[model samples]
Target: MTDAILRMRGITKTFPGVNALADVDLTVRRGEIHAICGENGAGKSTLMKVLSGVYPHGSYEGEIHFGGEPCRFTGIHDSERHGIVIIHQELALCPQLSIAENIFLGNERAGRGGGADASGRARHGRGRGGLGRLLPGLRLVDWNRTNHEAARLLERVGLPENPVTPIADLGVGKQQLVEIAKALSKRVRLLILDEPTAALNDEDSAHLLDLVRGLRDEGITSLIISHKLNEVLAIADSVSILRDGRMIETLDPSAGTVTEDRIIAGMVGRDLEHRFPPHEPRIGEEVLRIEDWTVHSPARHDRAVVSGAALRLRRGEIVGLAGLMGAGRTELAMSVFGRSYGTGISGRLYKDGKPIEARSVREAIRHGIAYATEDRKRYGLNLIEDVKRNVSAAGLDRLARRGWVNGHEEYRVAEEYRTGLNVKAPSVLSETGKLSGGNQQKVVLAKWIFTDPDVLILDEPTRGIDVGAKYEIYSIINRLADEGKAILLISSELPELLGMCDRIYTMAAGRITAEVPRAEATQERLMSHMTKEQEQVG
Candidate 1:
């Protein structure tokens, strides 16, 4: 029997009016990959936070045992001292900093005069240290030595050796690897990864999973929290299900009894016949059309993100744009929605076969177009604002009279959608940022739906949301289509696209490579188009 590396008993966490976790118990064995599965807001993150000391000792009721010793970690630093590290779903690395600097940020070296410097030689890099004395140790950084260590750590996490590169320069997958490297920098006995591959492409996700298995071989234990069932089955040796912040069961993966359905059943307390509802096509006339659309990347010159892309969305149809990361599906949607993403965009759009000019977001909305961005926190919704403000933001002009905002009108508008969309929030005045990711996404959706758009472009609409929330969003999409709204769905999950869309268009290198109808689309065909393979010469 493998030795248990970490154990939590009767872990109960409570917030103002909600029980985040209740009697949750999890046992992670040494050198094994243990996966935690649950729906969104099921308390997966809260449970991890408890274990990693994010909630601290007295803040929550729990008993944590790490490596056979009871622990009461006051903060993240305290947990790190005991070789416990967690890489959250949202990476904690500074995008502006170099890979090396991000890895050694709080643990940086200082000059002889106690000034911050990265030129020092290497010394005690293990565990966390106070920021005050960090600067005085600059002489110990040793760029060459730090780079060598960083390179080795990156290799361990299946990343390329480029420590000097800025964190922003790397792709999401690479940045995730850097997060893992940072965690591994400390003498991590147990590593906790929350949605590590959520943003990664298939190739990158596969590589990260492989690295997890590699880490297990190296005698390092891991706790993986992910929504990707196939990925959990691929890498996990043991699987634990959490529901409503409580542990349901822990099953051995090698027993051959554990299946995706079983995991879902354990998670939701009922059998889910299908992960997605069956789709029936009710095709209609084209409501939106794009001709010879092209967009240059804002960050890169001489690069076209969307190159002569042409597509059509008919009323009562959901057209899915499927592609690998960097394929420009989001860019194309953003540029079409009012040139919100790129520069030098040239696209001729037609509404009901009549040319329509949309130079900005307002113009796009005025022309009955609404776009829900993938990155809800950064682009879709203002986190600091309340649900009422966020939901009524895009359509504030409708609620305004003579340049004086009508508070009651806005509240009524927000209340209508809040109830209509089944948004779970304390009140309309609740801050959008305080809501769970699923709720936040719903607010963004509510905002767009309020626009009464003829054509709605949903970019990764269900990304990072829970399965329950996904079902709601899916149902909303179907209803919108049934109501004769033209919907353009861009998603990374092929299954989602296949399940919800009437037709799926696969993109490769900023161009539509294949258009597969719901009747014909398959994972095999879609993946073929998504992979970056050179086009054959005639």
Candidate 2:
């Protein structure tokens, strides 16, 4: 085997009150795909951040070796200069810019050659510099060269679209491709993808895996961090497991020895008997129903983002809404929850066979309905606040007396949820932003549950969390259903929907194409309807 391209020895990172990493070690070979798997709060992302210089050299105690040479990177730009690029879980793309502009955003062709106008040609001896040189000076950008190069990179990533297209018009999967293309433009030798397929659909994720393999064949090393054990076992040449910020073991799946169960055991320190908890559903009368619901795009009034969609949630029932990216499942949920999203919304919402007026967020809560947004970091939690404040944010009225919050009551309420949800935090005073993805999600759930809503709309509840955390969240959902709270689960993972939902609704192109019961629902059956495009009738 070739020598290690990247190595870290005796790495340790500490926060104010937490020792996030303790005596960690990792080694990655050249031109191989290495995957890091762990439970939430296991320090996977923190380790990567340290490597990529987001934490910098002095911030953490560690020794890093790249290409057999000790290196101390002071910042992300310094790491990028050495042919290392990182694509974070949350995409970092500017929605207002065109594809070509976004690709070459920071690294413009300003000082590079090729970007010259006609006026600059006559100024600095035009023919003196020959080809590849700009004609002296032109402050304006060369759109032609920029778009042409961007198109080549876009094609290389298998994205078929015009380079002039606005980023806002593209879906999440396409946005991910753009992120990869941007990384390629940086001439990256070692690419680090953190939860690359966390939000992708089945087809898009497969294509991405194929692309990663192709990159490996082309001699580019990759370090992927994912919660999906199957993908890690399938694509990684070596798998490294982390638990509570410590290195567990590294396994090579090509030896035909390691399995998903083994990896799960390593992550959680024990065997997991089942993925989903047992549930005895007692579905009763309908709690919430939407009829002929339609929502127009907030960006374009002429465009209808969701078209003629209808769904129902009965008491004590867990229903799944399955679809690919841009399928409008989120839009449907948001629009119904007090018209939080979309303009020109037309819908009829009935609770207990009677129409309810949910014209605003306050009214929506009053009507006993709650919606958890898919983008938790953005809309779900006040990241800067402590867990206690965030947990009680949704139901502040319950802890308020004469419009003033009662401190003791608030603390008691937050502590109850902190213990009940099994949130991994030192105390309720822990910052919401400082917690890991799974704990943050639990806090979001706590906030909504405090509202005591009879109907809950959970969108991508376990999108980026690890398997152990996912199981816990699933158990919580089952417990909620057992308590007669109606749940509408929106997920991109078909297996999750099939495993946890009593009935599944397949949506495509903003429409509910098919509805299948648990007895008949499968990934294949749901996917068939999910990818079915709306027929054009002239």
Instruction: Compare the candidates by lDDT and give the number of the best one.
Output: 2
lDDT of each structure?
Answer: 0.85, 0.88
lDDT for residue 290 in candidate 2, whole number 0-100? 89
Predicted candidate 1 versus true structure: per-residue lDDT over 214-254, tens digit per residue: 88898989999988888899899999998887888998989
Candidate 2 TM-score to native: 0.89
Residue 296 CA error for candidate 2 (Å)? 2.6
Q: Give the Cα-based TM-score of candidate 1 against the true structure.
A: 0.93
Structural similarity to truth (TM-score) of each candidate: 0.93, 0.89
Error of 1 at 207 (Å): 1.1
- Lowest lDDT block of 10, candidate 2: 117-126
